[model samples]
Target: MIDYQLDADGLATLTWNVADRPMNVLNQASIAAFTKAVERAISDPSVKGVIVTSSRPEFVAGGDLDLIRNIRDVAQSMDCSGPVSRILRRLETSKKPFVAAVNGSALGGGLEICLACHYRIVADDPNIQLGLPEVTIGLLPAAGGTQRLPRMIGIKKALPYLLEGRKADPAKAFEAGIVDAVVPSSELLSRARAWLLSAPAEAAIKPWDRKDFRFPGGSPQSPGPIQIFFGASGALLAKTQGNYPAQEAILACVYDGCQVDIDSGLKIEQRQFARLAISQSTKNMIRVLFYDMNDANRLAGRPKDVPKRSFKKVAILGAGMMGAGLAHVASTAGLEVVLLDVSGDAAEKGKAYGAAILEGQVARGRIDESVRDATLGRVIPTTNYSDLADCDLVIEAVFEDRAIKAEVTRKAEAAMRVDAIFASNTSTLPIGGLATVSKRPARFVGMHFFSPAEKMPLVEIIRGAGTSEETIAEALDFARRIRKTPIVVNDCPSFYANRAFAMYPYEAMTMLAEGVNPNLIENAGRKAGMPMPPLALIDEVSVELLYKAMKQARADQGSSYCAQPQDAVLIAMVEQFGRLGRKAGRGFYDYPSDGERKLWTGLTEHFPRAEKQPSVEEVHERLMYSQSLEAARCVGEGIVSVRDADIGSLLGWGFPSFLGGVLGQIDTVGLPQMITVCDRLAQHMPERYAVPQILRDMAASGRTFH
Candidate 1:
């Protein structure tokens, strides 16, 4: 809600506070109310100046995304966007000075509102961030942000914030010409009023309003503008691989807007925002990045019947890299951690790993030595099983063998309390198979943390057949406590992430054997927006482990298993060439101690490159589509929800966020079109590329997975 109050000094303050909402967002109702408030202050002869501030902690977060997503067409988008721009224009042209009192973060349209004011004075809070970050969620700043930001800061300086949607601290905001001054939080309102009254009437006018105004970075015809616009095309392609329409739209908006006047520039921005709004890419991004991500982090499917459980102490078995990282995260969250290993020395070494991490933080000034010591002190390292007696939960981070996991399951359960839950940090093994060895199968679950657990954000919570809702709720709670995003999944070998992720390297190997150039394969992977090239990723995950996982999967599933044609490639590399992986300093790519690694030239001897090589587009589809189709199968099998599928793909294995995860890719390409592509791919590799029945059904019904 917007409230207007006039001070005795002829200064009016408009306060923002949305009812029943923690943050103020510019929705239709709010925008209408805001326009009315702005009109009141501007029209009143008694009110000489206006100071805009928030009653809440933050000034305004941004436009309500629900409203943005509701935009069905250009008409609807313009209907939503037009009034705000008109109101801001009226405010700036009223000849009544306006000062923005940014008490906290002013992001997206929030900052755009500030840009319409005569001056912006931010509270010197360390937590405040100011920027136009709409591009992050597949939209540009439609409320004159694209036009105003570039005009204020110049195109070259503003491109990073607009293109990448980077947030800036209060100090950086002042430096970036986003704010005129940064004052203490207590003085924010007072300073705003003072500036509003003292600032010259001519200064209140926007740069575009002045007859002498010139484009800060020159028009599109200027050399700098020419180079920036043309140069940005190749740079953005290299970064995004042309997978995201939003990035290209951003560049287009900035370039096109800069060529015209302020009114025309605002029109260009609004038109571009409309185009991006209706884009399938934008819809997919909003679905996964905003809605699905929020649901996963909030534990949407958490059983309402089960009461929340707070984990006070946790025991970790096998104090290796995974276990050590677990100890660090747990202790960092102020939970008591018992790190156990086969020997006291090994456990101590794990504790030492935590100490080292804490020391690094202290050295970096992230924490003091006292806090480091306190966090390190929380981790109790010992070989004795009795040390885990008081622990509320236990996580087994041992080897990925079923026998070894079962052995630790028995030992950990013997020491754990009867009601305490048990979890495995296995990347590939099925939770149901491991739960069979547990005394309390109902409390057994899988908390699959990726490698370097302290860093990776996702934790795939696998539910066994007998695992209770209480166990899932408790696991999710614990994951949230450690600041990790948890995605609940059904019991399946490799579960969600690894199951789909394996397709990348598999396709790369298949291509290699088919005489595609190794360089081309890796280049396509990078161009397709994977975090690392397929060959490099294989090296990091290790080829020997891949082979072992394949063998285990084949043996366990028997006739139901899908045998990949590229299995022989992995076998030959690990067994015949004696190249285990990065660990062995050799694999698909040779890893040397001195410099950057390159594709093994010897690959040509084993599988010679074809004279007629596949194009990057063909290779990119093979690698990405293989994973996406497998993800569709996972959804069909009910191993994961559509939301979880998207979240897991992005956070779990570094799927391109711009593509909005795997399901997003399907939506972007269209369900029927994706099916057609999969059908074509199946012609080449039926075992890997076969379309799931669910996808076929959806295509027939004209329905999307999301």
Candidate 2:
């Protein structure tokens, strides 16, 4: 995998190109080959210095997660990280200068390898990212990242990249001193060779290994670093709520390791990595977030017989936030978008949304002005249905009303190609029911994009009863085209994500109706690792909207509908009181124009706090079990698969990555224990807490979701 070449000038070049893999990863086999190549260069009298580069598009993708996933103990974790760490350390101190010519994105172990070199240079490609982002996947950088990065930059400057797993492009990386230089792709290798050829013997030795070397800013004990560490620890606790051990472990590694020599610091990093690597949470995260998520993105469940589809031009019906956001993503993906609305002005306004977002990206230096203009130019806003005549796909993102959706569906189909797919961006409405209005029901499917569609990572592809395999494939293709993770689910009310996620807010409101303190309810949700507390989440989504959805469901299902305990609170917030939501500047919490939002003082008058309140642990369990149980029901009902359920839960909503999504949470809580807890909880709310038969069967068979 490592191709070694030597020039007459005594400069060795090692190019990494792993066979059968898209990107080079640090695994046992690859690491062994790399070590052999490095050793050869170090021992050869003809070799004076070395340049490390990649033949693949990306320098390296990081460690082989498959290898890391199987690590079950501390020894195994050490075995996985130790050899690579030692090899990198040896390369830096071999008395021969080494330079990393990074051609593309280098992350985690990849960036660690770059740090080991005497000098680092990268291609000036906007897509080339450099960072140690191991904490995001529930592990720290075990191969000398935590130590070398802080030393290369400083404690203050490096903490964000290390702890938060933030990545930077070539310019930002060069500015932050993560890279020594940024050059054109053509000059990458030549520049590395030039630097290595001119370097003195002292350049081979790292600053940390020198006798008189001082830290870039100050040592770990200095007042500035101490304050930064304290603030970082507190911020990490507040953000992660102590659920993610990787962040805490990373902090400890940087704090403790920076105080010692480089060798000792590497050992400290390895130990911290081992502790996190062997933990169940880490394993769960790697399994779901990495493997399962990759599977979904690859459309693993797509019908085998159907050929893949590619969308060229897409027409979006309506110019609201969802429609505009869809237009932005479609245009960005190089598809011509026809943004249609009832009025010409309304359509223009929708197109402006994409322009505003692109402008912001340009202002932030995320994209070039030329790229922004090109993307904006792809969107054609108008009121004419004829604009959609040549579109390959047409999605109706109009209001969530049957009549309005039916009107747009009929109109768009009339002007579109006979084989072109039609979809609805519905969050709760059933695609099967909506398909009744379509002339070609087989082509009708649900492409449910979450709010601010361009940003959300997930696109729930709902398959209607009549949706053809080809249509499903097309929807999956479109979702993939926009680089969004696609999870296929059978059509039902709320499909999968909304059905399972609704339980979170409902449970919180039920607690409020039971006289539980609002603050305690909100805290329970946050401590459970949810992105937003239930009350605040509902306010953002709007209490009036929830009330309307509840009313519609009650009307549709008639006597079959089961009223939730939260229904009374929803009605009180919307009708009895004038509290609509955040839009109305009042709801469960007041949204002042000048200050942070807090719970409405009048909440106590309507729902008095109980003399004896539920424990925070109890509240946390209730909220978690409620949502997870619903997710299990979705799996049992065949609405979604176990993998999709987990992936959807994590990406669709902000289900904590550390918990490994909803079903993974159940597996984490052993099935037997989960069922027992559900039985206990069933006494309070039997209908809501009822355990699905799938969990009981899995428990009986001693099976886990993974």
Candidate 3:
């Protein structure tokens, strides 16, 4: 894993090249090898100095997160980081000068290793990123990162990278004082060698090791530290609402670690790292964000017998916002797209939307003009059905009406080739019903793209009863091609995401009608870590549209539909008050052409205020418990698996990441406690808050969702 070589110039090179792995990660075996290499370089008669570099395109990713995840307890977690910390400490204190030649991404423990060297010279590659991003995975950097970074860049300046997990390219890293020099990729080694040969022996001792050295931003009692630490504490509480322990732990590491000597500081960071590594929050985040997300991306559990497929051409049958956005994203991903509509003019209008978005990208310097032109040129717009002749797939993003969808399916299928698949982007309609018009029922699937398809990261793939495994695999592959995360679900009205998501707004509206202050309701949603307050989200999705969905559900589900109680709130806002939504500049809140919006003060007139109201905690519980209960019901009914339910709740509806996802929330707040809360709420709203039998059994058994 560590190759040690001494040249005629007395400069030793330690190249990291872990066998059988694409990228080198600092694990127990590699750290032990590195320690031996360091001792050899220090004692060898022929070696005068050392140069640390990589044998691959990138240096290292970070410490082995898999190892961190497998830790049985705090002692094991400490053991995981303790070795690397000691190795880095010995290298930094060695009398012989050491320089790092960073080739590519040096994140987390990777950058921590570089910080221990006397000097760092990076290749001038735009793709090379450098930073300590341990906090993103819910741990502070344990290998002297907290102590070394602030000593080099000052505490105030280093806070952003530590807090936000920000990384920078070579130029930015140099500007941020993370690296000593930037050179051409070809000259990186030569530059490191030259620095080692020319620099005095005293350069081996870091500034932090000097007895007379003062901290860059002054001591912890200085004005900058006082303001940044206190101000950031308040901001963090407001942003996270104390839901994430990692953020606060990071703050604690920096504040306390910077107050002592370098070695003591590293010890402080190590203990904190162990504490957070074993935390349930960190464990939940790793399982969902890393393990589950990676599994979904690879299409795990897909039929192994099915052959791999690639999508080359696609046809979108509509010219509205959803269709146009799909065309833009498809073309951007190097696929030929045929955008169709009722007429040539309408189709051209849809094409123009993509052009406008690319032009905006050009204005922001994200892409050059030539690239924009090339991307837009791949989209062919026309009204004729013949344009879809050679297409591999056709997605019908027409209006959400069963009759309209069935009509489009029949028309588009006639133009599609024999092997082509048909997909529907219906938000609420079932895929099995829409597939009735397809001649090859097994080839039909649902690829439900969220609104503004070009930007949303998630695409919910729904499989009807008759859909073939081949078709499902192809749909998932296509979703990957478009750079969208997918979670497979079985066909149902609203499928998984939308079915559970509707409960969020319904509960919010119920609160509104019961005379809870609109402002309080909105604040509670934000404090609960929802991306948007339920009312604000309703306005963006359109109050009129939600009312129509509710009406449709009532007609289809009969008088016993659970959302009926929330209908009065939607009716008064859309019909009686003439407040359609944000598009109409009025709803539960007023959206003006200019300036900020506030709650429409007239809401109390239609729905009178009550003599007493529920606490903010009660309102928050209603919002979260309602959606989570529905998610569990979806899981119990087999509409979605346990992992997919959590994935959908997170990417589809913006469920808070700190809670992991809907199912994760059950684990965060113990299952039995969630059951108790659900029982209390069910006393008044049993239809929405009643716990599923599966949840009750799990609570009784003391089992978690994981």
| Model 2 lDDT tens row, 1-706 | 9999999999999999998676899999999999999999999999999999999999988999989999989999989999999999999999999999999899999999999999999999999999888888899999999999999899999999988899999999999999999999999988998898889889999998889988888999999999999999899899999999999999999999999998999999999999999998898899887889889988899888888887889999999999999999999999999999999999999999999999999999889999999999999999999988899999999998998999999898899899899999999999988999899999999999998798899999999999998899888888999899999999899999999999999999999999999999999999999999999999999999999999989988999998889999999998899898999999999988999999999999999999999899889989998889999888889999999999999988889888789988988888888888889989988988888888888888898887
lDDT per residue for candidate 3 within 1-706, as digits (tens), equals: 9999899999999999887566899988888888899989988878888999999878978887788889879799878999999988999898789999998789998899899999999999989999888777666788888888988998888888888889999999999999999999999999999999999978999888898989887877799788989999999998887877877877887899888888888888888888888888888787787788878888895778888788899999998999999999999999999999999898999999999999999999889999999998999998889888899999999998888898888888888898898999999988888888889999999999998898888888899989999998889889989999899899999999998999889899998888888887888899898989989999889999998887888877896776567899888887788888899899888877787987888987887787898899999999998888888988889888888888788788889876778989888888888888989989988777888998988877877888
- Per-candidate clashes come to 0, 0, 0
Off by over 4 Å in 3: 20-22, 212-220, 557-563
Per-residue error for 468 in candidate 2, Å, reads: 0.8
Tens digit per residue, CA lDDT, model 1, 1-706: 9989998999999998887676999999999989999999988999989999898988889989888888889999899888998898788889989999999899988998999999999999879999888888888888888888888888888889999999998998998888999999999988987787788878778888888877777766789878987888889988787878888888888888877888888888888888999877787778788888898888888988889898899999999999999999999999999999999899999999889988888899879989998898899998988998999999999988889999999998988999899999998888888888998999999999988888999999999999998999999999999999999999988899999988899999999999999999999998888989998899899889899888888888899987678888988897799888898898888877999898888899988888899888889999999899989899999999888989999988988876789888887778887778788888978888889899889888889765
Worst 10 residues of 3 by lDDT: 556-565
Best by lDDT: 2
Q: What TM-score, computed on C-alpha atoms, does each candidate reach?
A: 0.94, 0.98, 0.95
Note the Cα lDDT for every prediction shown.
Answer: 0.89, 0.92, 0.88
Ranking by TM-score: 2, 3, 1
Q: Which stretches of candidate 1 lie over 4 Å from their true place?
A: 20-22, 211-232, 359-365, 368-370, 554-562, 592-595, 610-612
How many residue-pair clashes does candidate 2 contain?
A: 0
